[model samples]
Target: MNNTSTTTLTMKREFNVKPEKVFDAWLNPVTMKKWFFTLEGTNKVAQNDPKVGGSWEIVDHRQGVDYRAIGDYVEINSPEKIVFTFKMPQFSELEDTITVELKELGQGSEMTFTQLIHAENEEQWTDADIVKALDEMRDGTEHGWNLMFMGLKELVETGKVSYQG
Candidate 1:
């Protein structure tokens, strides 16, 4: 049986950089490692093959466990749009899709990111636990993405990458 309930999260940010630069940061392994897994522990592996049908993977060592995130690119429209299927081994039952659109804004760029997440079974869990898990997931996702964007912005606008998060 599969859970029919889904969650969609959307976020937008404006960067003082060109769309190409912003887009490159997402696919380039060196730049991506600077921001990709900021929420969890250190990233043990980061690799990306930025093309339609190509795959990407990241492994993060958190505490004593290794969490692996794998994804396949579904669409790549240059500096304008990207779509991918994302999966995390820690949440093996759920499969998610992420879509990112970048629009040129004067001399800068604005990016819109949307993620659709299908949650796993919750039958054996209490309502409060489910709610709490959802809340934590939302907050953690938001925080992680924000930090990544900040890292992107800093790298693009100032040519510096800080791993403070």
Candidate 2:
């Protein structure tokens, strides 16, 4: 999600790998954690269930506060597209959609991540406390995504995943 209010962030990353493998990484828990984060440099995959009513859990042992994103699959097309509703009510945004699309490119694939983020702060203009909370959440969430994606790229390319997700 974009921090610039109402708008969402659209990041496209091209990988020199097969579409099936790339797509599998997204659906397979082990694969997902390897390239799940949009930015990179993050780890800990408790449960990355890809089916409907599945979860994208993480390890809280690395930090003082535990965080998790639970979601249900809205749509799934193997090696092509995936749509899911992600929610972390207490820690971050709720009712967000994470969609990933894979397209073959020459001898590689292009993985596009599109997120629709709702600025919870946009609706709480009158509440200073809520705005403050939302601000911090947005910053933290984006950083997390960044680190996750970076880590994912490294893991996938190296074929050395620390966890199966």
RMSD, each candidate, Å? 2.8, 5.6
Tens-digit lDDT track of model 1 for 135-154? 66767788778888787888
Name the lDDT of candidate 2: 0.64
TM-score, every prediction = 0.85, 0.71
Per-residue alpha-carbon lDDT of model 2 for 62-135, expressed as tens digits? Answer: 33554555677877888899888777667565477888888999988888887776665544355665556656
State the TM-score for model 2. 0.71
CA deviation > 4 Å runs, candidate 1 = 2-4, 38-41, 124-136
Q: What C-alpha lDDT do the candidate models reach, one value each?
A: 0.80, 0.64
